[model samples]
Target: MADIQALRGVRFNRRVAGPVGPLLAPPYDVAAEFTDGGEFGIRNIEASDLGAGSGNHALAARRYQAWLKNDVIRADPKPAIYIHRHRFLLQGVPVERTGIIARVRLADWSERVVLPHERTTTGPREERLHRLRAVEANLSPLYLLFRDPTGEIRDLMAAVDANPELDDHDQMGGAHRLTAASHVTIHDRLASLVAERTLFVADGHHRYEAALIHRDECRNTRTADRDSPSEFVLALLAAVEDPGVIVRPTHRLVTGGAANTPDAIMRMLRRWFDLRPADVTTLAVDTDLVGRVVLPRRLGTWDIFAQRGRPHLELLPLDRGPAWLSLGVTAIEGAVNRVFSADSEEVAQHLFPVVEEANAVRDVEAGRAAAAFLLPAPTLDRLLAVAEEGDLLPPKSTWFDPKAPAGLVISDLRL
Candidate 1:
């Protein structure tokens, strides 16, 4: 059974802090990109003591204590599950993703209570572990997907959404709301709903692994307390059937050498896969390519994009060289790996992954990256299937939309 429960969350004092939309930031990894000229940036906490040669994790712990002392943040009076809602636009279409934030008992992968879709790198995992050791707090919530065909959780969240405690709009004009559900009756219903369900880590795989590491370390050093809060990690549980949940493509930008010239790269791409020039006259005007020719997993059809002087190439996927790579994104990665010596350190340096298609093309035009190989976004079903089969995907294959903002509901490890 999946053990999910509420906990006392530390939050910013709204009276002293004013609006929290500016205060609530995305996770540390993606927080840097969204930093504005604000005094309450979490980057301030994560990077303040880095230059003095002090370890970041220790500094993070100190910062947390300092913030608590200064009334920058305070813990809730009672334990409760937080209802989080994000309303934003995707390709001009409005989307709202609602989830319940709570602490889940950490379980081993062998136990299969919490699962992962992508293979995580050791460097990130270790870094997260170090931070966990020093701070002993969950600064951000990991996004998890659970099977909920009957919308049991959704209906419950809807009732709470009617009257949220905090409702504010972020700088990007995205709506964010937070509400508490402290009643045991509702809590028990939710716990029972997920008692037999498995959670798939949608993002923050490294942090989840670090939680396990910390749990194990605590076990070896001291007597194991099965009921201790240290055995849990913060997570935002969203249903797999949420229509707003969609996977976006992160296109790869290859710069320098042959990639600098479309002709040079075209010569290499043609050797293994059939390339046909395609005309894309609808990129700028069409905000959402709902009716465009850009379709993924459609056999023998993938678009290769370049600047004005370069020839546009499309893949003839009729022959994928016996690889059962059904998705266009997977096929592109396969061809790029086979045709280009991506294994070499020299080639890897020039490669950059970007989420925006317009930005990818702009980088190539402005001479930042030599060329960009554009690929369509894969369906959520396709991504889950790959994970279920025990197969791994290439780096930057998927990017979930409107990253769940951090700093809203913090899980205090000391609790």
Candidate 2:
């Protein structure tokens, strides 16, 4: 069963930090920019210091201690789950995504209580483990998506949203409102709603695995009267039915087009996709073409942008590839993996992931990268089906937006 418990969250005090927005760091994995110290800057989180929130784990802990000493952050006197609401605009439409930040007990992926959508690399997991060992805190919460068929949990979150304890407005025009749902009755209801069902890890694959590693290491080395907080990781769980749940695409930018011309790449790509020229001088003119289009419309169709050409709309035969390979993300990854290498692998060597298509296009058009493969965000149905089948799409497959903010509510592992 899924145990989504409340915890003594360590958070920055508004009185000391001025605004939570400035203090908030984008989830360690998806940080776009680092603010040093200004009207827009963060204080001591050292976001850029470590790629994934803790570059120097000891230094990170020291920063935490210093902040605590200076009254910048204080631990909640009582245990509570944070009801969170993020309001954002995507594709020129307003949306409000609601979720809860709570301490979810570590459940192995094999247990089916908690699930992982994508596979993870080893190096990132190792780095996260080192950081967790040095600083006994969760810098950010993992993003999890669960099914609430009857809307009970969604209603509970809505009731709590009426009176938020903290309202943080970020520079991106998104508002993050947090409320502590500590009442015993409400907590029990939420626990019941989220219990015994599979909750998918939308993000934070590395952190979750790192937590498992820490728990295993602790179980062997430590002695404690009660279960340790290391047994759980900070997580924000959103209902699959929530209106605010938006998944954005992570466009892939490949390097070295100069050496391997677009014609050459396209030639290799034709083995899998039926490539045809797409008419558009600019990527922005028909943003939806790239933003809305999903491949295998009839066959293997994907709009692609590469060096010095109009671009191509690709289609693959429905009967040609495996049924699982029909997924747009999977097909694209497979094509890239096949097309861009000598051994028909090593896509990572040529690939750079991007959150924005403009940036992806700029990098390609400006000669910064060999080509850019823009993608549409995978549908909720696609993600669930893939996870249910116990298959991973690819690394950097989904960019769940707005990326969960860090430092909004820190989970103290000691608790």
Candidate 3:
């Protein structure tokens, strides 16, 4: 069983942070590009050269402190689950997503109550653990999805949105353009429905794991009855299908590897894969391109392009299995590791989801990457199924968009 609770959150003190845009940054795990030395345009705002911890995390902590000290970002007087409303554009279509943002009691992974789809690296986990301890609060909210087929959860969210208690403009980027949010407290009516659903880790797997580790560390260091905030992990629980949610494909870049040429890749893949003229020139445009990916041992020597711009590659599985090779992620990982020396981390670092397939293909034709691999989007069902079966997907498998904005709400770990 999982335990979810309403928590007293610390909101951004508008005085010190000024406009939210400058303060917002994307989640640390995601590839975030900052301006100059220290500032990013993403909603998970942070300042400083080092993103997660750098002086940036520290700066975020300081700003959090200033807000607390001056009552800039104040804690809710009562413990309550906030009805978080995020309105944004997805694929040029305007959409709104609502979820109850709350502190979920940490569940031991051994218990199999909460599952993580993607794997985490040690370096980033350590960095987040340190920042969390320093700030003693959650700067970004983790994304969680639960099976809410009945409209009950949606109705609950809609009711909260009907009469939101707190409404604010995120105004993250310049021109004050950013996702708009509305935060409402979850009253007694929806508590039962929320407690019944099993939560899936849509994002923030690393942060949640850090929470467990931090909690154990705190238990050892603190006195009895310390009531450490690490006891609860900050999360947003939403339905599996939310209008504001979007999962984008992750493209893989093959450089400096044996799998460079198409023939070399095709020959190696012939054991299980059947090659055909993918004739799909517009691979990048169709976010649904699914095909087996193969490259020669010398993948580094040539250029691979997608959409005619940069080398874009998508991987589809040639084989199926209940134990392995059934999923595209599995096949791709095996091919990379067995055929080339690329590991999971290497795949994560090198892959970029095909943004424009045609443009990317042009780049390949012009000699950019030796070859590019494009893949189909990973569905929410596939992710949950993979985790439920006690398996993990390749890193950077799915990119969930409209990421929970930073600075909107903060969960402090302090007593």
Candidate 4:
């Protein structure tokens, strides 16, 4: 069972603050040009004290202090879970995603209530820990997916959306986008409905991981037995069926070597599996398939990628490899591991996988990575299957779109 509770959120005083855009920021891990001078630039969140060192850590600490002291950000009057709605378009298709922003009980992996899909890297965890120490607040919301069997949660979400107490509007990429937040206390009658579901994390694996570390640190530092608010980490819960959420593929960018042509890539790939030449001219791959990602090495022609793992993609369905080992992403990772003789350190430095197809190809062509491996997006079903099997998908395998913006309803750690 999931524990969902509304707490007073920290927010900026809109009247005192110039504009929400200056305070609103993308999630900490999101890739955006910070140096760029624009409203959506990374400076918004930089106002938060990130930490006391150089690089992102120091920058984030100093900014956090500035925001707090300048009254750029403030805490809400009471505890509450915010019902958040993001209206956006993908490929010109309009979608409205809804979820509740709240503080969930901090549970270890053993509890099996809050689940994570990807593995977290140590570097990000350390960076997050630094930020947590500096701000003592949840800088972002974890994306959680829930299975609402009774449809009770859906009804509650609908009721909340209809009569939201706070409606925040922003000019997200030109068009006006609206985000509505309401107190969970105002809708306290639905607590039972919120607690009945299990949440699968769609994003913020590092945040959840950071919570575990923070909780441990608190337990060790207590001079006396006391109930500290850090017991619960902040999160945003959306029933899986929420319309505003969309899962998009985070295209892979290969690093470390040369920009190989389609034929060269095929020749190299043939050592492991059979080859299928996709007519790059007409059979352009759809980049948005949730789990079944495609790798298109644009060597004057686009090559369609099909990994030999999934039920649909496993054309041969060989009986040789371990069942879990046969996932397409895993296969690709294995191949890269062998080809580059990649160690963990090198993997972090040069051979990074990106989530955009064009960016991946460009990076390789521009001599950043040796080759780009584009993948199909994993379906939500596949993610759940992997978790139930006590396994994790390859890192950066899935990209949850319409990620919740930070600073809408900040969680106060001291409370």
Candidate 5:
């Protein structure tokens, strides 16, 4: 069973911190790419101190202490479950996603209470663990999904009538509103609703693993108690049936491979997939198809009329099981492996995942990449089924849009 509890969340003091917009940042994995005027706009918690050096961890810890000392950020007076409503635009369509931010007891994989679908690498897991040890806090919330067919949880969330404590937009123009629900009755009911259902990790697999390791380490050191803060991780829980919970497809780019020439790659792909010519201008491949390949144009950019003759390959598998072919990312991985005669490790080195189709196309047209493999987004039901069956998907298979920004609510594990 899953144990969820309200947390005494740590938040920024807008009066002292100036504004919440510049202090917020994306998760740590992509925070390196974000810059505000050559540096983070302010000495924010998660984005400012992610340097590649070993001393970066200590720097983050020092900055966190300084913020607390200067009243830039402070902890709540009482424990409460935070109601977060994240509103953003997806493909020009407005979306509002709501979830509860709470502390969840960490469970080992063998327990099977909380399940993860995507595979994680060791490098990221270790890096997160090191940062956790130095900071002793959860700077970001893990995105989790649960089954709520009865809509009971949604109704409960809607009942929260307290005024929002933080209502503002981030640098990406996403609107975030946070309210604290401190009613003991509501917390008990919310806990009961999720107690019977299994929790699925929609994102933050590496950070989850790091939290588990940190808990075990604390136990070994005899510093943890029965209700130690280290035993739980901060997470944002949402229902799988929520319409705002959207998953986008991640396209793959091939930078360096043995099949460097377009002809060589085409011949190899033809052996396993039936390819059809597609319009280069609007190469929106059918979702029912297995995959699509965009090779580098020989002469001009994709916008030019002369480039319209470029061959855009639409791939359909010749023979494959429905169970295996249903996963678009898995199918693409298999085709890439077979085409290049490479194993999973070799493919990881040359093949990179990109969330935008335009970026993938540009990389190929600009001669930076050999080819781009565009895939269809996987359904939520399919992903959940794989997790329930104890199966794992490829890395970066699902991109959950409008991610919950870091520093909205921090979980301090000092106790």
Candidate 6:
């Protein structure tokens, strides 16, 4: 069963911090531009105070403690589950997503209570573990998805939205509002609603692994109690059925390999795929067909291909599982592997994932990459089904838009 609890959240003090917008930041992994501010806008938690660099962990710890001591941030007196509403525009359309922010007990992968659909690398896991030990806090909440068909969870959130504790906008012009539900009865009800459902890790695979490692380390040192803060990780839980739960495709950019040449790629893919000519203008207007097109740099043309037939599945690489075969990324990986005699890791090294089609094209046109493989976005149902079947997808498969930002609510382990 899933174990969720309310947390005494720590947030920035408006009087001392001046404005919440400047202090807020994107997730650590995607905050490269924010982290390069030197010492000017360096106050953003994701940049210098969080896990941005290897040698900055100790410095981040000192700055965090100083902030708390000087009233730059304050912790709530009562424990509560926070409700966060993130509002943003997608292709000029307004979209809003709501989730519950709470502390969830960490469980091993074998336990099957908490499930992850994407694979993680060791470098990121080790980096996050060091940051956790130094900061002694969950600087950001992990994004999680759950099933809520009865609309009971949505009803509960509506009541909490009547009043908001913190309202602000991010650097991207997205609106954010946070509210706390401190009543013990409300917390118990929220926990009960999700007790039977398995929690899926929509984001934060690395941080989740780091939390497990931190918990074990504390136990070995005899410094952890049954209810130690290390036992739980901060997370934002949302229903998979929510309309605002959008997933975007991540296109691949190929560079410096046998598969980089247009003629070579076409010849290899023709063995299993039927190729057709496609115009770049048609692809630009219709995203549905974008996944099927491949653009080679300096070729000034694009080709769309479809699998010839449901060929023998046994002959293909079935190690990942049958569910993975339905994804566009899986097909691209299979083609690259068969053509170049490479494995998944080797293929990953030569291909880069990009969220926007324009960006992918720009890289190829600018000579930064040799070719681009545009992919289709996966639906929420397809992603959830993949997770439930105990299968894994390639890294950076789905890009969740309007990512939940850090510094909104900090989970201080010392509390």
> Which numbered prediction scores highest in TM-score against the true structure?
6
TM-score of 3: 0.78
Top candidate when judged by lDDT against the true structure? 5
Task: Give one digit per residue, the lDDT tens place, for model 4 in 288-318.
Answer: 2212223344533334344344333333224
TM per candidate: 0.83, 0.85, 0.78, 0.81, 0.89, 0.92
- List residue ranges in candidate 5 displaced over 4 A: 37-44, 48-52, 259-261, 280-288, 298-324
Model 3: per-residue lDDT, tens digit, 191-254? 5676676778888887888888988887888862424577888887778887666666565555
Runs in model 4 deviating more than 4 A are: 31-70, 174-189, 223-227, 257-266, 280-327, 341-350
Which stretches of candidate 3 lie above 4 Å from their native place?
A: 15-23, 30-59, 165-189, 224-227, 258-263, 281-325, 341-368
Per-model C-alpha lDDT, please?
Answer: 0.69, 0.70, 0.60, 0.61, 0.78, 0.77
After superposition, the stretches of candidate 1 with alpha carbons farther than 4 Å from their true spots are 46-54, 256-264, 281-324, 340-350
Q: All candidates: CA RMSD in angstroms?
A: 6.3, 5.8, 6.4, 4.9, 5.0, 2.8
Candidate 1, clashing residue pairs? 255-370, 300-317
**What local lDDT does model 3 show for residue 185?**
36
Worst 10 residues of 4 by lDDT: 287-296
Regions of candidate 2 where Cα sits further than 4 Å from its true position? 36-43, 46-55, 224-226, 257-260, 280-324, 340-345
Which 10-residue window in model 3 sums to the lowest lDDT? 173-182
lDDT, candidate 1, 24-103, per-residue tens: 66676776566661665555454323443546777778878888888888999988988898888977888989898999
User: Rank order by lDDT, top first?
Assistant: 5, 6, 2, 1, 4, 3
lDDT of 6: 0.77
